[model samples]
Target chain A: MLKQVLAAGLMSALVAATAQAQTPPILKMTVIATLSGPQASLGEQVRDGFALAVEQRGGKLGGLPVEVTVMDDELKPDVAVTKIRGLLESSHQDFVVGPVFSVVMAAIFKPVTSAGVFLISPNAGLSTFAGKACSKDLFVTSYQNDQPHSVSGEFATTQGYKRAFIIAPNYQAGRDALTGFKSRYKGEVVSEDYVPLNQMDMQSEIAKIAAAKPDVVFVFLPGGLGINFVKQYRQAGLTNIPVLSTFTVDESTLPAEGDAAIGFYSGTNWAPNMDTPANKAFVAAFEKKFNYVPATYAAQSFDTAMLIDSAVKAAGLDHDRLRTALEKADFASVRGSFKFGVNHYPIQDFYLAQVAKRPDGKLQTEIRSKVLTADVDPYAAECKMQ
Target chain B: MTLLVVQALNGFQLGMLLFLIAAGLTLVFGVMNFVNLAHGVQYMLGAYLGVMFARIAGGFWSGLILASLAAGAFGLVLERLIFRHLYARSELDQVLATFGVIITLNEGVRLVWGSAPLELPMPDALSHSFQLMDGLRYPVYRVALAVTGLVVAGLLALVVNGTRAGMLIRAGASNQEMVSALGVDIGRLFRMVFGVGAMLAGFAGVLAAPLVSVEPNMGDNLLILAFVVIVIGGTGSIRGAFLAALIVGLVDTLGRSMITDFAHAVLSGPASSRVGPALASMLIYLVMAAVLAVRPAGLFPLRS
Candidate 1:
């Protein structure tokens, strides 16, 4: 009788273990960003914004635990591709986000999207994915490269800057910026200058611009190059010519340029001082956490997190269902309202802002005017989403 | 015409900065036979320290002095701890070790300052524009940079030609064994030379910080140009570095600006726009390649 009882107990324990094994551990999701490189600031902002959204959602998505994996891509396209591939393959990440440069974004698009894994681009918006090569598995929480610059051109024309000299580094993005600007502005371009991407000295270019004497200068220099150009432009006494730029004079650059950035106009999709309650709260929380004002990159990144959270909550955590829900556009963003266009780019407003001294005596950007309200990116016309 | 003059002056200023960086790199290579990739990181450290000092001292001069001193001290410590080990090792080992230092310093700066670029403000005295000619005004600060670079170059030339340490350095560059055999303390000479070389690079960084963004990886791009300058100038020759740096600065700056314009005149607007930047960037490398073809040992190779 005792031997019979022991066999029954052992069988019961085995049965319980098998049942637990059959039920897989609660679905966990991992979000990763490119956290090192020249553009680490953008990656960090996105990471912060995404984390804030997760916390606001009580640290869970779709009633299941979620995890975020922040990895450094070092801004190298190849490194980004390799690191992202490893993250997706080795770690079994439910979703992936970012590698912010368009070069890197384009590099990794094929493998990540072909595998049917969801990719949410918080900053980079490469034109190829937004048009002929649009993917069902891809969604962009950021504006296309052409959108803001197109609006900038229109705004410059409206301000009576008929003769404008355009400048950008010699790169795909640089060519795109000039193309985007020209598409909207019908005025005569006085001259277009292309400098090397890593070219730091701008004196000769500044001299040439002075010689040309254009009514205004529109530039698309990003990161360190932008800071160098703005200072050199001022040093060259070309400040008398109103300068209008895209991605050249934003929060990412404001701290570097200090008062030199003042009075220049920058066109972007989002700014920290946006007058929405969500944006206000976001800026407050982010500043408190990071001890600095968050740039548009950070705001968009935060929205990307909220975007995933909303989709995951609305449609159970099954990968396909969550992707479908994300496509439905159920989340309210800090940018007031954002909906994905047919091209997988955001249909959003673009604002013209001036770098000005705030009440706090520190240099800050203030929205001078709203250029477009719910702007549909031009690439959408080319997209064939049914 | 005045704009042309200003642009030429600007080019000269840029060349001077390049010379400051290249002079040290070439000297270390010629004498110590060290391939130190972290030299650029030291320049970056100088900029960061300058900004920090400015913040602490609340004055530009004080900050500049402190930053140069600090950078020199940091270089000494680095030599003792890291660079000393690699000096006797193979060139490949030295390259690897210095590259490691670059990575560590780049990441270290990121951790300490965060990824955001910091601003180093110009002093109140150097903030205004000075009118040199009719309808032409340039920032006083840039003019200052040019003057400062010229003065440093002059001082360097005097030291190299007239001082005991200079004799030792020149002798060490030609024959390290002979200098050591002649009762000169080779190790002490090397340490002093390394310290001075590092200080020159650091001073350039501090001077540049106000004009450029103080961010991580700021020096890497400049570092490449400095290498080009060193190669063209010939190793261990301060005068060669100065001349080569100016030539490079002028060519690069002028080529980038005018190449696109020339392209536009010859080609269609869009086509020129596409081809201009790409070609202009290749100009410097092409110059370097051409120079190398003509003189593999460089234009002014040190005479043993």
Candidate 2:
């Protein structure tokens, strides 16, 4: 009876070993974002880009299969904190991406960093994270909040605009944009306005801005608010005054502004018109898959996937090794050359572009010139990251 | 001084647009006692319809008329099929049902128009800037909007105060059961009121479309402001809605523009930069709260 019992135990051990050998190793990834509200389009674009990249890489990262799960924070910061915690503790995801808005990113900062999961930001580079609170686990592929605004301010100042009016929605990004612009712009600021985040009416404010008689207007209204501002600004006869902006005049907003956007100036970290071979390939692949041109948000998301793929390849998908490899910067991005600053935020280029009519009669934007190249963000010096 | 005048006119024009939307919301609530959250969706429908009509008809005026008519007809069908069932239900139930309608409509718009903002161009005649005074120029379309809103407001006042149908509506607001028992077809009256309310909201939307990008959730933000207007003015009075809407529009626009400068005068630049926007946004909410505290049923409540 003792011999028979020993034999059965040996057989049971062998069977368990065989089953374990057949089970594939999991590379867990989590996509956390604001899935509802006005910014849903941004989230959807990011998601599609990431999915397309994953499929192109054959659903594998560095030859190891990956499992991706997406969660919506509903644009609420408190909800984002809890959701990130749940993803780390229960889901055991090795990497977490997003919480698209800067406010939401700030909310989830501690939970995500302390948990030691790789936090990859495809968009929303909050300044605070690029400062004293920086973490090695947190990496941002997106432009720093101040990057585009700073370049835009420089361009406007160079254009001989001695006095400018600044307008933005009353939100974290809005405040940052104005601050970023003022930091670089030596010109006199005549007036500053902060409209409600979703304000649709701007007649009174437009009147006040006209009264101020600023040589140029710099506005940072994003998404639907951007569209509304551009349309109303044109109708209020503010079009003749050069309008300089960051988020207000992107491809995502150009369609809505239509002909009103023509002749306006904008600055961005990335554009579809970039002449890099990688960019051309990315645009072709994205257009073939989605049937529409990829916006800046989509490009950032796709680059994030490539970044992960490079890290995985370099480190063979082992969680600790992959994290270290990502931190060491193993990827070549479509944005030409980008390296993480000590704060894990990108040090990259920003371009000044103009909204113009294309040969096809559609209103589109063209990159006029590079405003800042390989620019290190202002907050980087404040970061004490090892 | 000319710039200030232009700004004030702009504020007044915006107020007029808000009044158009609030007027309809108040009428439906006052007469039918229904909290129709989907009223904003009706406005969105009007904008979308306007775009569609413009694409088909190839002219702005023709598109505006057809879109308004289509939106009114759509409202009638919704009243018969959905809203009529909830008149006897609780306000919460009506709110939930209307919210569902909003989601469906918002998503439906995305499916139909894609997730891009549609641009509606003004006619060539209205595109140019007209000088108001001393080199201050404003868009002609905005001036036209102000005039149109005033005319509509006048017609609304005349219909509510002078016509037989107006008397029935007043009586219905005062006592619905009495109007129903007086051998009147209350169902037809409710349907007509809903339709008219929808038409007014849609007309405002179409008029505003050329000036603003027509996008999903365009009505949602406006709807909140309109509710604030109705709550401050009183639920049933058109005059109250108009006054409150103008007040809200002016305060909101002026406060946002000047708050930073005002704060800078009292505090350091850094402090003002930090506190200005936050304080400016809180001002409107504070006004709404103060008004509510003084008059729990609103500044002017229609008898219900």
Candidate 3:
């Protein structure tokens, strides 16, 4: 009777252990985004996009219930580092998502990756992490930082422009913009100007552009800076010269920009009006839920959520298995066809998009033409991930 | 030559805006001996209120007056509730409390208006641009902005130097205890000064709304520059604030435009590319340091 009791107890314990293992533990995720100041709109889009994906899955990612913690980076690198360190110590997060600005990404990249957590960037895809510093644990759902700018460069070349005036905010991404534009444009760069990142008053810069009188102007000012620059640029009557830009004229700033941004050209990986069925569903659902037109930031973030869900579904809770599943990238992206390069950055199409007034009187980007197909980032070969 | 001409106008316009903001800040610092860091929020409130009132009043011109009045009323309310008690407190305490107010109001506006920027459409009269010179098409609204700023400065000069209230304010700035002993209601005078100062800052904001993006924390950057203006101009002198503001504005604008060429002439290509923009940003601070070193009492010290 004692032997029988022992057998029953051991069997019940084994059965309970199997049941617990099969149910899967709850997944923990931390989304660190710049959710304050002028760039807050971008972060809000990212957060909402990710939330939409999770909501569609009934608050679960890959059949496992997820508990998400969203933290604001405030667009300051130091603040981001402090918040991320506190986050790292407080909980065991399975995946870390976020950092809309490249500078914030540079700050939080190592700490999250070195702590053995997967860092999935929904927006910022800094070149520093795409090449030699690329980590097996880091995945980017967005195009490399230079790809969109390079598309503008190519577009300028195709338009038979012989002279270009380029300007960007003085920072790493700004430098990347110049390099990318120069790489494709065979035109004479009449002028290259880098303004202070927070310098809102661009009257002097506009005067300089007027003086230079380049055939085409390329600029990469983002957020509030873009809003001011575009308005001032139009007000100064310099619209006769075609302007090629990235991130400056997008859904995020179009509301304030209004008629000023109409007919302005930008380059990006995807636009709001992409013809894919998945994209259609996303744009409709995002607009329904958020009451605002979705930008590329939101699109990339939605892809990030889907990427995480697919990996988790295929690999369960195993780290190595999850990495392999993410590498496979077997999911329908809102961009239609999505795949990861060797460095885990996206190998995708780039398009030249023009800002147009939609039928509903909303300003948004409409795809003009494909600039590059199956484009691989220049830094992928330097990555040792393969 | 035309580029230079247009840029100088740009500088002057910017200077005019700075003067409007610094005019009030200097008076408060001089008369009340208060370091109200939340002065910038008054400018932000002006812009936000200007946008709202414009929507309601159905025109930018009417909206400008209503918003300025509203901002001034809000400033009076703030002074009564919080600032009145802090007049006897330490500068550090005042700073801390006002800083708290800045954060509270910034977040409050964000919650109320949402974080995206709002546009205040320029009136049809001044919406277009004119050829200031060859290759220089300047916006008419900006020119109007400068003219309005100058007119406001002139009116303020008349009131401060010409009126009975102006005499009391000057006396309070020099010797508050003596003015109180003379049976002047010093508290009421300070409140009036504070309200007028806030109104001037808001007026600057409404004028600037059409020229710049009206967003949350927009006033934060301008606030620092206003403080610099007041410090360099002499804490209480409106004339000094005007001259110093023009100097700061012209120097900042010209430095940004010409610094790259200067760097390229002096340094190698890559080095200049990096150093030029950095130096341009630092130019104003460097100017302030030099001025302070030369004249610690500022260019027009009220005490002197």
Q: Which candidate leads in lDDT?
A: 3
Q: After superposing candidate 2, which stretches have Cα over 4 Å from the reference?
A: A1-21, B133-136, B254-268, B271-301
- lDDT per residue for candidate 2 within A1-386, as digits (tens), equals 99999999999999999988799677899888766666767777788778888998889876778899988877899988887787688867777888578888888878877877788999989888888877878899997888888887888777778999898888777888898888789899888777778777766667776667788888888887788778777766665678888878877778768888888888887777777888878877987898766678888988898888889878875667876788766666778877877788888888888888767665656778988889998889999976
Query: Which 10 consecutive positions of candidate 1 chain A have the poorest summed lDDT?
Result: A24-33
Estimate candidate 3's RMSD in Å. 2.5
| TM-scores for all predictions | 0.93, 0.91, 0.96
Alpha carbon lDDT of residue A265, candidate 3? 96
Ordering by DockQ: 3, 1, 2
lDDT tens per residue, model 1, A117-145: 88888888888888877887888998887
Model 3: per-residue lDDT, tens digit, B276-296? 999999998898888899999
Total backbone clashes of candidate 1, pairs 3 or more residues apart or in separate chains: 1
> Any residue pairs clashing in model 3, and if so which?
none
- Report the error of model 3 at residue B187, Å: 0.4
> Model 1: per-residue lDDT, tens digit, B1-304?
6765766777888998998888889889888988988889888999999999999999888889999989888998999999998888999999999988988899899999988888888888998988765545688998898888889889988988899999999999999999999999999999998998888788888999988888888889988999899888888888889889998888887677678778888998477877877777888788889998998877888962
Give the range of the ten consecutive residues with the poorest summed lDDT in model 2 chain A: A357-366
lDDT values of the candidates? Answer: 0.82, 0.82, 0.91
Model 1 chain B: weakest 10-residue lDDT segment is B130-139
Best by DockQ: 3
DockQ of 2: 0.52
Off by over 4 Å in 1: A1-27, B133-136
